[model samples]
Target: MPIQHINPPGLLQFDAMSQVVVASGGRTVYIAGQSASDVNFEVVGGNDYYAQSVQALRNLRTAVEAAGGSVENIVSSTVYLKNLTPEIAGRFLEALAIACEGKSFPPHAFSLIGVASLAGADLLVEITAVAVIDAAVAA
Candidate 1:
């Protein structure tokens, strides 16, 4: 794994994310957007941002693991939040911490965007990620 997480001197650092991630010499894995839906495509959380965020992050972890990588291998991610607010962001951070089993969330570059809606009315968050794993480690 040749991934370097950097938070430049002048840039603000965050516990949940890295300012930049540089990865080389690995198999790139592009994970599709994962939401709070279960295997049956039923929304797991209803009108609860924290619950939805937890489910979404869990789904993302599953996707990465399926690609023979873990959350630590993720280099970048894009988060889409419907009706974003400070409270919602706070809930998301809490959810992320829980999803990581109380460990620090992976230091992956992240972009959060606020949207008006998602694929479904109940969906509150969706996450898409990109990860890199050693060629031999790929499934």
Candidate 2:
């Protein structure tokens, strides 16, 4: 594996994500921010944060796979949420679990940012990720 997840002892560890990630000897892949838009550029979820979150994560997965990598290859991510709150964040986590096929999301360095708006009016969440994959896999 080219990626290593670490939650140092002193740092507050969360089951859904890792505090740190170490990537070695692989081609770094930078994924653009993905929202709930579908292949037709239409938003999949409307006015529903959880639904949009799930769709956004699914889009992120699609991008990673397109780069010849899996969600497990993700080393870092930045999540942007519109009008975020604790309850909304919980919903996002739930959506993440669902996106990961009922399993916990792959551990990775992550940042969550509350935003006033996104590219689309209906988009409630957007995810940007970075992954490291073997050169052979990328070929």
Candidate 3:
């Protein structure tokens, strides 16, 4: 599949959503809200935002790849947190940075949201994304 990126002049030249158009066409994989849970479906991080965010991202990655996708296939991701604070946001970014280490992941549309809770009480973060895989390419 062919992908195109567009960045207008009006908005700030930021990474996420600093542009308008993302991809042209492909097979879309819609990942559900992935929480900080392991194969057993138990929350990995208790109340820690950083730990939870990291685990959530990891979960998201696994789901995407299992569905015949990859990190580079992700076109957009939404991060849902228990609270949206500067410190928390920083921690989340840190977690993301660590998780993306030694990977071919690229920046995509990102949005952060503050929610009262998630699937479980102890969970603190949930990540969901849209991945586009070319039909000719296998996974």
Candidate 4:
């Protein structure tokens, strides 16, 4: 990946992202926001937020990986949940941490929001992420 880690003499690079992610020599891929849908596009986990969250992440991972990037390469993520509360957010974080075990430089920019409803009645959560895969790697 041409995504180089930047450092300023007195700055904390670990907590901050590169000022500008130069993707010149790499292929940029954009994945539409993904919902918790199965192979048949049938939304999963009707009323179960946690289950739906799990499924959403799984779906997001699959899409990103298919595009030549892994979840670990994800630089940003946005999660939309229905009726999200502090407790529910914590649960989602926990699940995310578990799923990212052993993956370095896990998602840096993360956003979570609660929405009134999703596209389908059975959908409870949706996740979208951006990853940079070096063009050389993809080639």
Candidate 5:
């Protein structure tokens, strides 16, 4: 399964994300929405969106790896923010960049939402992702 990332000219040069991700060659994994909760389901990084986003990304990584995929395989994701702000958005992206092993990763596409709340008051972020698992890699 060969996944091709397409970045057409005149458009934004995609970073961690691509404008179009062609993963038609393998299995697509739809990971459930994840928040900044620990193994005990207790929310972490209370009141800090950056910390919460980092935790959420970690959860996403765990799920992806468990499915025989890596975070790089994620093609798209949607982020939910309890209190959206410019600083918060920047912090989230900063945390994400760090999570991507200090490299640029935007994925194929992403949608960020401003929400009143999440599953709990302590939670500040939740992320749902879609990824492709190469058959050979999964094997």
Candidate 6:
């Protein structure tokens, strides 16, 4: 299956995202919101935004890869945090940018929201993503 990325002309230079993603005949995987919690559901970071964010992304990668997709196959992502600020948001984007490193990762659609709390008191960040895996590649 071939994935098409849409980008319109005359957009600002800072726009780093494709307008949309069109996948043809692919398997869809919806991962549950992954938090810093381990398999036992114990929070990995205690009131730490950066650490929790990293762990959450790592968990998201594992879940996606287990379903036969890699981080580059992620089409969308939603991030939730207990405390959201300009600085915190910058940190979040910076972390993802570092991981991508000029690779093509489906659509760049994503969100970061501030919440009162997460699943646990120690947890600070949770993330969820949807990936499209090529079925033909599997067989």
**Candidate 2: stretches off by over 4 Å:** 135-139
Give me the candidate number with maximum lDDT: 1
lDDT of 3 by residue, 37-84 (tens): 888889888788888877887888889889887776777788898868
**Which stretches of candidate 6 lie above 4 Å from their native place?**
9-19, 99-107, 135-139
Give lDDT: candidate 3, residue 109: 68
Write one digit per residue (lDDT tens) for candidate 6, span 3-60: 5655667753234355565665788889999998999998776666766766787788
lDDT of 1 at 78: 90
Q: For candidate 5, what is the total of clashing residue pairs?
A: 6
**Candidate 1 per-residue lDDT over residues 81-111, each given as its tens digit:** 9999888888888887778765756768988
Q: Can you give the TM-score per candidate against the true fold? A: 0.92, 0.92, 0.83, 0.73, 0.85, 0.79
Clashes found in each candidate (C-alpha, N, C closer than 3 A): 0, 0, 0, 0, 6, 0
- Cα lDDT tens digits for candidate 2, 40-117: 889987888888988888899899999988888888999999999999998898887778766767778888899999
Could you tell me the lDDT of residue 29 within candidate 2?
95
Candidate order by lDDT, highest to lowest?
Answer: 1, 2, 5, 3, 6, 4
Winner on lDDT between 4 and 5 is 5
Which of 1 and 2 is the better model by lDDT?
A: 1
Better of 1 and 6 by TM-score: 1
Show model 3 residue runs off by greater than 4 Å: 14-21, 101-105, 135-139
Q: What are the runs in model 4 whose C-alpha is more than 4 Å off?
A: 1-24, 100-105, 135-139
TM-score for candidate 3, please give it: 0.83
Question: CA lDDT of each candidate?
Answer: 0.85, 0.85, 0.75, 0.66, 0.80, 0.71
Which ten residues in a row are the worst by lDDT in model 6? 98-107
lDDT for 15 (candidate 5) = 59
**Model 1: residues with Cα > 4 Å off, grouped in runs:** 135-139
- Specify the poorest-scoring 10-residue window by lDDT in model 5: 130-139
